[model samples]
Target chain A: MVDWLTMTIQMASLAMAGWCLVSTFRDQPMLVPHLVGMGLLWLLVIGQGVVSAVALIGGEGPEETVMYVSYLATVVLLPPACAVWGFMERSRWGPAVIAFACLVLPVLMVRLEQLWNPVV
Target chain B: MSDTTAPGRALRTGPGRLLVAVYSVFALAATARGTYQLATRFDEAPAAYLLSVFAGAVYLVAAVGLARAGRASRRVALVSCAVEAVGVVTVGAVGLLAPSLFPDDTVWSGFGAGYGYIPLVLPFLGLWWILTVHRKDRARAV
Candidate 1:
């Protein structure tokens, strides 16, 4: 996993979470802009995933390969999955769902980092 | 949220939507952890892993029941939430008193502290949301 990419995803996810929180408080439903933002975030996550996958194929990965890959798959899929789920709802809670997913993304990235580079 | 018990205003709108999402995540997390442990390290801790899988199944049921948004599913979801609440407390207590019983950390171990204690709080939230929706729907119908 690229360090800069991981940092970028975390920052972007938090920013998305903040934006969605504002929308939730303002009683605004999920709009096109939220979806667009999620789309961009998903693209970034996919990039990180691809890099990790390539590295793994090249035999540079943690010992807990299965757990790490499962987590990787989850991180890659989460944004788009939540975006679709949230978009289906036509209420302020739609953005709330996105916000929750966005918040989780950062934590998952942290976990990924630990898995990728466990410290002695 | 037009405050109507309309068809479109099903259980999976508003707060229910968020609940469903959270439940789905837990379901995935618990099920994954349980299955992975059971498959690879079952000899180390069978009971704990089983409980994890069971909890995951309950979460899955609750999520589906809420997302489906019908009277029957509501009942299903309600019962599962009750079961989940009881399961967490019982497991948590066991972990505290008889740690040997678990021998490993399940989702409910230490009241879900492993998973940031959300497992402890989730059932109550689910109960509140489901009951609230039922009461509101009934009140509007009347």
Candidate 2:
């Protein structure tokens, strides 16, 4: 796992989470810009996933390869899934859902990092 | 099976939407962990893994119940939520009292201390949402 990319993803995910939280508190629904932000974040996550996949293919993966791959799949799927869930609801709570998903993303990323470089 | 949802007040709307989303996450997390543990290390801790799988199933049922807007589904949600509330308290207390009993950590172990205690609090919120919706639904009828 590239430290820089991991850090970037965590920062961006937290930022997205904070913004969505602000929108929720302000009684604003999920908007186009929020989706676009999620789109960008999703792209970043996908890029990280692709890198990890390539490394795994090269036999440089972690010991628990299956678990690591599953976590990656979940991380990759989360953004778009939550985006659609938020989009379907036309209420302030829509942003709340996104906020929750965004928060979870960073945690999952942290877990992924741990799995990638387990402590000996 | 019968629909009891109010106009613009479906089960998975407003705050309920957030609840469903959270429940879904829990459902996925718990089941994945539970099943994985069951598959690889069930012999190491059968009781704990079984309980983990059960907890995951309950979360799944609760999520589906909350997401679907129907009279029967509401009842299903209410029951599952109640079950969760009871399960967490019972398992958490037992785990606290008899630390060695589990031999491994389940979702409700230590009152979901591993998952930031969200498992402990989730059921009540689910029950509240279900009841609040039920109340509003009843009020509309009367």
Candidate 3:
């Protein structure tokens, strides 16, 4: 189910972010593994975005189409943007960028869920 | 310039860069949200949406000011940070006390409660960083 995949991606993203934060505080470079983890997360987000878009178009009737689309756009772009910015810094800040991005992932996921099933 | 060359000049080269990075992200998010809201649903919450636009502008200006690190940029950043702090506190209070007034949420609603209160904390951090960096420059001058 899409819900399961989304939850998995969210947890994985958070774990990666936590790892990045620890590494940043410890003053370490973001190794290849870190980058790869982020890449996979982004791929998952992209897949989610496509699924959500299709569902919306197919009359699933997202609670707020505008908000849902905005969330989708933000989630899809987040990882690549962070990757570019992180690579540029080349210091402890690089891992810090990853940390921040990782932290935001869960928040975005929560928002996405809310948009899908708004109570009010 | 020599002051920057001085050994005591604080390196803007560490976590400081990460601060800028986060600020930049907020800047982009706020701007996009404001623009989208204004374009699509202006009638729904004009005041809140406009405030979102203003918050975005302040974030953008502050981020640029911090990144430049020149004398003028520092002054701009200080002013922007002050404005942001005032705006967040005021909007947060208003949103909490007069929830009906905001038909929809803005970035400062309940002191950025939706965003983990980062908006409330970010301005303080920005001002602190600016002052810290300036103090280091002054010390290096002597």
How many residue pairs clash in all the candidates, one count each? 0, 0, 0
Q: How does model 1 fare in lDDT?
A: 0.93
Better of 1 and 3 by lDDT: 1
DockQ score of the complex predicted as candidate 1: 0.83
Per-residue lDDT of candidate 3, residues A32-119 (tens digit): 8888888888888888888888888898957577778877888889898887767666577888888898888778888788878877
Model 1 deviation from the true structure expressed as Cα RMSD, one decimal place: 1.7
Best by TM-score: 2
Each model's TM-score, in the order given?
A: 0.95, 0.96, 0.83
* Fraction of native A-B contacts kept, per candidate: 0.83, 0.70, 0.57
TM-scores, chain A, per candidate: 0.99, 0.98, 0.92
| lDDT ranking of the models | 1, 2, 3
Identify the candidate with maximal DockQ.
1
What TM-score does prediction 3 earn?
Answer: 0.83
Model 3 spans with C-alpha error above 4 angstroms: A54-63, B1-12, B95-104
Cα RMSDs, all models: 1.7, 2.4, 3.5
lDDT of 2 by residue, B38-95 (tens): 8998799989988888999999999999888677888888899999999999999999
> How well is each residue in B22-117 modelled by candidate 3, as lDDT tens digits?
778888788888888899889998988888888999998887877774567778878999999999999889887888988799888999998889
Question: Is candidate 2 or 3 superior in lDDT?
Answer: 2
| Candidate 2 to truth, TM | 0.96
Candidate 2 displacement at residue A41 in angstroms: 0.4
DockQ (Cα-based) for each candidate: 0.83, 0.59, 0.43
